[model samples]
Target: MTSPASTSSKKSSPLESSHRRVPTACTRCRKRRTKCSGTNPCRNCIQNASECIFQVEDIRKVTVLESFITSLKRRITELEEKVGKKQKGENGTQMPSQANPTEIKDGVRAPDTKQDAKCDDTRGLAKRDSTKFDIHLEASTSEAVYSAIFAIFSQSPSDPPSPVRSCSTDESLYNDVLLLVPSPGLAQLFASVTFHRFSDYVNNVFQFLNCGYLSLEPLALINQVASFCEFEGKWRYFAPDAFMAKCCMIVALGELYEPAYCVSPRNVRLEPPLVDKVPPGFAYFKQAVALLPAFIIEEDELGTQSVLVVEALTLAAIYLRVINKNIASSNFSLQALQMTINMNLHVAPLETSQEDRRLFWAAYSLNRTISLRVGQPLLLSAEEIATPMPSVNQAPSQKQELYKSEIHPCYIQLAIISEDICKTIYRRKCTTQANGVSSLPRFTLSMLNILSKLVRWADALPQNLKLDACLTSQGSYESHTELDRNRRFIYSLHANYCHCIFITTVPLLINLVQEQKQKGSKGSLDNPNVWKIIHMNFEACSISLRLYESLYRGKLITTYGFMDHDYLFSIGLGFIMGQLFDFSAYPVDISKYEFLKSLGKVFNILTNLLHNGNRIAHYKCMQLLDLIRLNPDIERESTKMAPVMVPAAVPVAIPPPVTVPIPHPNDFFLPFDDLLFAEPTVGMINDFYSTMSVDYYNLTEDDFVLFSDTFDMHV
Candidate 1:
């Protein structure tokens, strides 16, 4: 394939070709090119898309018979000269007839030396006579096959270097390319690759996709699963796709099983913060999540398998309850959990039988509630060490072996899946966007998936629970120090999450800035990356939302488990936007109190919106943020201020569902355009991004290039 760089290179100008009049393909071939069973797709064309042309479009300098004879005779004479020269050099014998008169000179095959070995390297250097060419030939073409060939040739790294050039500086070209990348909206890319040439690939993969229950796979499904078990402190550079991988594995493996809850001393939360720890067996879980999607996804990225949301959440809850040291607060996860349930219920009731997917979600919600309700850590004490289990060698006794609930083959399957997801989510995250919405879920899910695996090990144990023979007499969890284990676990989890943020989020976000800046109004989904980033952005938000809901549902405040600092901060994003509505666009003029109050409102809404009725309100909250215009001084502020966080109370608490609806945030773009607020109740969020920092949001025309991405302005 052509490298993106090469495909953008300058093409030779028509003036550069001074000699070739209609330089083109062999006449014989052109006349019957379609019949020629040559090139990669020629045969395919003959049997299928029959118009696949084999002959090159442009006429060549030489005719078929003349070109062939010229080439062959030159080669023969060149060899004969070589043989004659060798004979003379070795035996002092001289060949007659001017050494076959085929030798070359001046690095060019002299017409007289066309058959000589001396001219071998220059055999094809002769100039062509183009003035005598015919002009009556037809202009035939190959569309599809050439398109594929163009893609390959354009992308191939081996191509000779050429000057780089944009097809046009008119900006429309850029907008067109930009439109081809992101996935912030509809599935524009669904037309190619797995769909081959249509959207059918997705239509074929999901029972729901074809039925219209969902369109364009939520893509966040995996992260939703990972969030429930999110134990990693905070994410670093994780990609949004990591979340999908993690969630998919859970649904594929543990969707229908009863979850086990056993806490491990070690756990990882979103990618990691700034710590390091000993690696655990469950780290493999992240790896698997990263890989599994390739098997099921038809697009370049994985498609949503919504079932993952239910299955993963259930397992993550069970694990958080059983594995890892206690956290400073359950508020982070609790708040998200409560909302997760409310959202699910609001979307569709949870009363359906176990056969229904909602049943799984309800079960998951139930499990988390039980885990968070606990006042202390299940596996770690206050000082932070692995808590001792009463069972043997971290194993069951001979009599306990007979019990099957935890040890069932299903549990083992879940464990295996968890291990894979943990590894997969983290591994691929290294390549995704960073700091942007696309990076969020990856950070969230890797941590959750890892925690889920460790926790499951305990739940899967036999109820009789006796130590394995090795640890029965000497091995014991009682010996480990809580503080030491906590430190180790935190460090490892921290390191990974940090990696996610730096490597994944930042790049993706930066790209988003460029993307949104370059977007045209003609079609949003046309750019796959845009759509991906947009979805990633919300999905990341969703992960945070779900965690807070879990904390709320479980009511596990003051417990050592997942912290809720992010929830407070995330909910605060809404606050900033709400504040923006009341304050001036000037950085200095924006009200600090308004900002604080808005943030608080966001948190309040987030906590309550988890209820069925408030989802529309929650949607409004997101839309409000999307409507926020940056303060003019935004660029002057340190990037540290970008996240705009408020210190969260430890053990964050959840509030009741919201019954009141919030007003839409003000817009800077054509404020009077009704379409902008037509769906004030709830609508997909749209954000303005820029590679270079800018205070403007909605529609300001400070950057001409930004508008150049304009479909409205460009044809």
Candidate 2:
């Protein structure tokens, strides 16, 4: 090797020697493929007596590229970690480290044990509590924060929940943590006090569940109307109608307000006040009604329908119903509906600022309910109305947040479902009859379609709105109250949905069975063709009874007028009738005693409600109870008669058997025959309903069928 290297060196040019190399010889060394040690001043530089430096730009570019690659690697690692965490959650097997990564030990993050994770959660809550007062400070500094809490409390039923993204951390505290701390300052105290007072005022004057059916905030504005007695003579003279309308509503609502059930005694009776000068509630209501048309004309002359005008009309209608002027109420309902339509509320644009949707839905609900009661066709349909479901989260200022007491989306869903029901079921009934065409086929199909739709509707409800949710939550007055309201609303929907099933199936089932029987086929409740209907009815009745019992004992008094009452009465009657029917007459799936027990509970609840000042309920319950009492116990009578039967040898002449007309299974009379056939006829059952100003026709089978599904039908 030495010999070859010596020969190569002797052959090489002098310029190739490292000692004679230029300052840039690193390139030459590289180009010539000779090695140069990487040092600040290498052999080539030393040979040239010059300091060596590499090209800066090339080194800088390589350095930058390396840094970018490193950053990309770091980001990929973070993404992988996140995906792993998500996978763990999906698998339901959380890693100890991921459970509470905030936990640390010995200057290093530690994996949280089960006990440690719980402790960490407790600490987090403690931290929130420690900063409760700081929220006021934040509120004072940030108007957005203050408005968020106000927005939560101010939410009208139609408005979506306030969005929490704006101040999630602080606003979330408003719900989960009870803010019982006395205000640290006047600003805090005033805000809290004002909100609580306003909330109470809204609750007292209006029903939350009815928000979708009606927005009465305009009535709140009306409350500001100066009393005629307090106004100066000239002012009173100018605004007499306004003052009178306001007085009428105030007095009417006063008369209608019953004391809370807990405080009201079983037999407490309130007499209308006999003031020397002030008009009675009814007189005031009448005067307001008489003046409404002219007042509306004046408003129209001035320009358009002011919210106050609409409000007056709505109040008059509502009070008309309370005062037993249903025809007048229906008229007012129509007027309000027309006014809302004229206002273009049902076609609310995406940019619509105020929540007129509540007003529209309220009027629509009222109209739909009245239409059902009167057997009239629905005037509104979802196809014609473009109003979207009210927003679920309101953005007050920039930050959006949800209240702990957020309104349930189920209410909106129910509203839509109800509209569908009206369109599919009631509309078809009214239209087919009006057209004077053969309707059994169409009617039967509509009923079946509605039944399936209702079942699907029920199945599609969110988990949080299910019956089980109604049974949970036990602590905290505020939480309990919110949950109670939510539970009641959910149960109301459940009751309504079930009632629809009973209505849709009963007639169809009966008709099917009867038609089949006419063709020489036997029909019974146990028959496969009819069992679904019977079983469904039994289940619906059972659920309704359970809800009735659960709601009767709680602070949640249902405020939806007549809906719950009608449902309870109908369900009770059906169950009791099923129990009373001679067992040998037909095959029944439910136990008699079980139905009897449910009937007892229903009667007790109605009695309690009657004492709580529900005259309609009182009349219904009394009639049902009286009829039940007067009827002979068929089960007992049959058992006793069986043993006393005469032998064939000593048989006496027997008259031809007396035939009594038994109602078709689908007939409403099937459940309440006692009321019609008892000894001395114990007064007409229809007469009892008349005592409360309800017409006998309003309780007919058609009415029940139509109204039962008013809140849920799919077109």
| lDDT of every model, 2 decimals | 0.28, 0.43
Q: How do the residues 195-238 of candidate 1 rate in per-residue lDDT, one tens digit apiece?
A: 11112222222211001111112223324333443254222223
Best lDDT among the predictions, by candidate number: 2
Which candidate leads in TM-score?
A: 2
lDDT of 2 at 458: 58
Give stretches of model 2 more than 4 Å off: 1-201, 207-209, 217-251, 260-284, 302-305, 394-442, 475-486, 509-522, 525-529, 558-562, 580-588, 611-613, 622-715
List TM-score per model, in order.
0.20, 0.49
Alpha-carbon deviation at 351 in model 1, angstroms: 38
* Segments of candidate 1 deviating more than 4 angstroms: 1-507, 514-525, 528-533, 536-540, 543-554, 566-715
Q: Write the per-residue lDDT of candidate 2 for residues 628-696, one digit (tens) a residue.
A: 433345223323433342111211132211221111111111221212211111132122212212121
Candidate 1: C-alpha lDDT: 0.28
